[model samples]
Target: MTIRTRCGAWLATLLLLASSASLQANTPDDQLIVGMNMNNLLTLDPAAMTGNEVVGMVVNLYDGLVELDPQQLTHVRPALAESWDISPDNSTLTFRLRDGVRFHSGNALTSADALWSMRRVLHLNLAQASVWKSYGFSKANVDQAIVAPDARTLVIRLPKPNDPHLVLYSLAALGSMVVLDSKTVQAHAVNNDWGNRWLTTHAAGSGPFRLDGWQAKDVLTMSRAPDYWRGAAKMQRVVFRHLQESQTLRLMMEKGDLDIASNMAIPDVRALRDDPDLSIDSVQRGTIYYLAMSMKDAHFANPKVREALRYLVDYQGINKTLMAGYGVLHQRPIQSGMPATLPDPGYRLDIARARALLAEAGYPDGFDTTLRVLADQPFLNVAIAIQSTLMQAGIRARIITGTGNQIYGAMRDRQFGLLVGRGGSGVEPHPHSSLRSLVYNPDNADSARLTNFQGWRTSFYDAQLNRMIDQALTERDAAKQQQAYFAIQQRYDQLIPALMPISQMVDSVVVNNRVQAYQPHPSATTFLRDVWKTPESLAGGTP
Candidate 1:
């Protein structure tokens, strides 16, 4: 590992530099090879998908009604739906489907297929279901909610008014509203599985690219869709090799073996800032990295203990030195771009205050606890910084590092004490977008199994928070909505639910200088259709 890397435990990550040989063809000028950190890819079925890696890949193979701009989340543009109209009450929407759009399976895109795809989400009750269920969509009423007025017209009728922007935002989100070749999926269905299992490996959508083949822990390859709905992609082929080592990715970029390194370690990313042959792309993503204290844990069940632990976090020390330029200091669940975002309380490490709060909560001396963290840079490094700072207040946090699934799975199962995890999709730049996940969970029902809501995983329930989130989302009056958000923040700060904001993330990528028009999406979405390469990089020459 390079100097100043957060953790020394995983320095062995450098050894892969010699082992990871180039996987791309030397003269494949029309190809874009990406190096991705593919760890928790669970499924490809749009209805049953959850992980970001799988959704990002499948999104290229599928078409939704609308999609967020690749450069920002400020607007949603038409995709499969050429135009749409919303009812004045904000409960009904009618969409006009684009003509001549063809799925990879050679089926024509139709409103019926879009309706079926949506019903599949409700029937399967996957992660996307929370977005709908939260809006009163249920299994019994899902079919009723969706209607096909004609082959090219689709209508969705909501039982109650909702934020039209948020509803459209959900459609643009990962696996939220994907249109499938319904006939093909139904033909492949086994035991009425809706092709959920078959789709885990095969794909059926109308996007710029279609799946050629995929292997877990190996590589995933795609070929440009022929006569794609939008147009043929600039690159004829795209390959994502699953390599998690920072040194190997850097070596590949140096040798011109890889066209783009999709992700890299923070230390290596910072080191490449001055490299002439490379381009650094980064953006503040719609996510928050934080330390979660499970309410199930007896010690953390005390609200004062949770608040005390928050003050113990040295946010400035971590963001400036350890986290450095990769992240920024943020305190609230609402991300930077969203409306009604308040200033950070700016709480720094206060050992004296922490001790006082702990005493007031009946723990005169600080308590011992475990802080499960991902075994990687930034996360482990941040965990270490927090541990050292907590020790000043006599709070001992035993660090446990593991893969993301292992650590986050503990949070989902409510089997953890404390974990360093990231939460909130922030799909819409709305206050409720983050609040719904961070603290709005009202009941830990089976439906709450949606990992999008981390509060459910931690058994953090607040009836008032839930009501406030709903009210704020539907409130059309700007000032009243802002008031609702501000009041919600006050209550959340008081109750000390699940998580403590560590930092606002800035996702980075190291790409060859020849890679052009490569804009990073706010959600870390990789839409390579708009990306192209110059003559130099295409000819396997130096950038």
Candidate 2:
């Protein structure tokens, strides 16, 4: 057998060594073994990493200037930055760097490194740069807009009007702005690539842990950084094994082989609820699950048809049944619990209303269309539920399921008729975050290529809605901004947006009872420095 295959077999044998009858935890007390699917872990580069799985890992391997408190998202906490201040005009932000911090490469951390990191993000123009670009930061302007006066001080001058608090939230909540070891990355730079090629598999960071090795789609291992500014991580090492099969994870967890399991199937999570040694943490994420229609397609372009599709969704039934551990019913574009979030408009599955609207839109008998969705639950299950409801209104929707890339790829290209997907930037705990991502489409032309914004992907454009979203984000008064957001939602609903919100996303993570201080953040920036596990002998079983 090949070396990789042999290694995989050996690991599998070790994992299988543990059995339920033995009831012994196979993991070491000083190490945290995490079972998860690592398919979406494409890169370690802070500017290019996508998905929550990578976000959780990146946060531990690198330190952002600030971080939002997991319990209170609005409260920004200091990290690399000892403190910060916003100018009275809300156009400038200044941050003071903490002293004595050093990167894994032993290079001293400074505001120059921070400035270089921010500039590199825009210069690279990768996945993480999109949000910063939307805030008027560009490769050309980054040098001027973001500056460092001394080794300890960094300043940012906004290119346009924006809420400084939201900007701070972006810096804290979004892992994209995390500072990097510029000297190390530059040393590894090849072909003037800014280390993008190298950082894909390597890391130059100053967080609680240092990247030891990463084998793509197989395993990722990191050990605690002894000289971490805050302190060394409680766990000596953290091993994330690629356990794609939910059943395998469940079996391993039952045998005490895994300290934590994320992205478990809902059914599997439900089965583990009664397990005494396991605890499920249902973290409420800001992203929303929704049904999207491509306005480029003639069928969905009609306002009446879009309105008909809204009434055709069985939102209540789907949330009550299919979305048990996946999500909760949420119809508005804005996520729930936010001050600006309004009550659900109380849309129900009204086949009659849908049929009448369809007829009014010149389709007496509902036309045929394809509904694309991920080939995973509860996306597949939710798509099936939607298909059944659409059929009730004489609308024939053939369900097409595929991998995330295949499905979302078609949507990004504006080539899909209908799609069941989950997205929206609730990372900052701001209404504008959701609106900017899901509803504020500045341009609908295919050439605009604002695929980062779901609004552009679905070809859902409204100048007035865009203006309102922009105005709300820049509003100085809190109450007035909230009112503006409320008005935006009301108007968005009245316009019958092509993207229909069905539920707010919830992520369930199963953890061993012995694991302590393991709080999962809503923004996906989960810090593992303080997490510890009880000793096996003291806990009466493996931890």
Candidate 3:
């Protein structure tokens, strides 16, 4: 057969296998098929992965020391560790490992494996190492800070003064610290890379599922580990298919081919709201969407320019019209609903004010600049909106759109002028989580290379702000810490930060009613071990 004809036949086969004429859950009862955009899923290595997409996958493949309850984010649940305790001075943390757990390779899991996994993160110094390094752990002191006294005892000594509670939250919420099968991973290491390269396409974990196969930006499949310590995953197999186009995912979900679809555009999600056989799950996330200015750029270096740009954003309009399904209006650096979080500062679009500020900044007629954004929905739309408003104030902003790699790559290298993006460290359900990721820049020198921090990426530095953030993290008195956070936000605003918060993220996923026990987590650590699907005949029934 001709190549084109063969390709056509293959697509027809997939469509045929996806559904029947009746369309009452054509998927198998023991299997789950998920559709999502995999553009950001570049790696599966726990120590190297970035973005929430990879976190959801990694948690199912590897067990963390603990996990936050999906319903109550602050509540930590035991996972690999059966129990844990902290010293009186709050300088030491000790975890008791659960016995009889084995990795997919049949190797018995031990405390040494957990300690080795953390040490590997500091050694690799990749994307996942950023948060750990911020906590004072380094490649040099990891062996001393994190030690395995016995096969069942894992202890961690703080290298610096920090809230042990926040450290515990980090261990539970961030998938980067998940325990790995040290032996299996070490066996695959190449050139002393600590198995990073090989782990990109393989997994050595003790979670409920084991990776079966993966094709980058295409399809990934995992099968339930038969000897999982907790219990076998309800689904015999789970498949994640990359469906970049939102409409394709909607159609597949409507046809019963996909049990769940994530990262779909807002309009498509709205279209399926009335579907009797489908349900929408909206999970509030700690991440924030905002407009970032690069201080390295001459136009935004001035505080007046940054303040002018902040007022140029139509927060209400964008959050009401454009961010309906994606996020809610949130202005403070800290996430909303937290006790430490303050109300929105209520900055609005005022072209005249922006014009006045621009004139004061030595640009009577605003200068031209470029705005970088991902080609994906919401981001692209928000950029367009900002571009229009910027032009109104005589500031011309050209929109440059590309894939996540192309866009974020420039931001990471500090080569962008202006960018509309989403980020914050809200995974741990703590106020410091967001401030540390978004506002804390410990080192201002370029040589520091703190690319993991958005503050560093934007060249936004303030000695007092850094001091307040550091003080807040270690402050033992809850009342004093709360006041410290308030003072930090006030100072951040007065200084005209390079990054402006526009919206707090809310992730909406369309799920087939046939799927049960599937709860999406705020931290993006969705577990599938308890998720199961009803038989096809009863798929249309209420979940």
* Per-model CA lDDT versus the true structure: 0.79, 0.90, 0.90
Model 1 residue runs over 4 Å out of place are 1-27, 445-451, 537-543
Model 3: residue 543 alpha-carbon error in angstroms: 12
Tens digits of lDDT, candidate 1, 1-543: 332341231223212322343443231456677887777777778777775677678778888898888655758789899999998888898999999988877888899999999999889887668878877788899888899989999999986667887788778866567899999889899998888889888888888998776777777777788889788888877777888788888877777767777668877777777878888887787678898898888888898888889888888888888776567888898887666887887788888889899899988878788999999878888899888978888888999999877888787788888887777777566777788777767677756465667888878888877888888889988898888888888888888766888788787888877777777677545577877777653454422
Backbone clashes, candidate 3 = 0
Q: What is the per-residue lDDT of model 3 for residues 1-543, given as tens digits with 9 covering 90 to 100? A: 453664465455345545552465468778788999998898999999988999999999999999999999889899999999999898999999999999988899999999999999999999888888888999999999999999999999999999998988899889999999999999999999999999998899999998876778988878789788997788987889999999998998888778999999989999999999899999999999999999999999998999899889999999999999999999988999899998888999999999999999999899989999998879999999999999998999999999887998898899999999999979998998999889999998888989879999999999988988998999999999999899999999899999999999999999998899999999899999999888776734432
Give the alpha carbon lDDT tens digit for every residue of 1-543 in model 2.
454774565455445433432555467788788999999999999999889899999999999999999999999999999999999999999999999999988899999999999999999999989899889999999999999999999999999899999899999988998899999999999998999999999899999998877889988878789788897789987889899999989998888889999989989999999999999998999899999999989999999999999999999999999999999999999999999999999999999999999999999889999999999988999999999999988889999999989999999888899999999989998888898899988888889889999999998888988898889999999999999999999999999999999999999999998899999999999999999998877854443
Model 2: how far residue 194 lies from native, Å: 0.5
Which predicted model would earn the best TM-score? 2
- Please give the range of 10 consecutive residues that has the lowest summed lDDT in model 3: 13-22
Candidate 1, overall lDDT?
0.79
> Model 2, stretches more than 4 Å misplaced?
1-24, 540-543
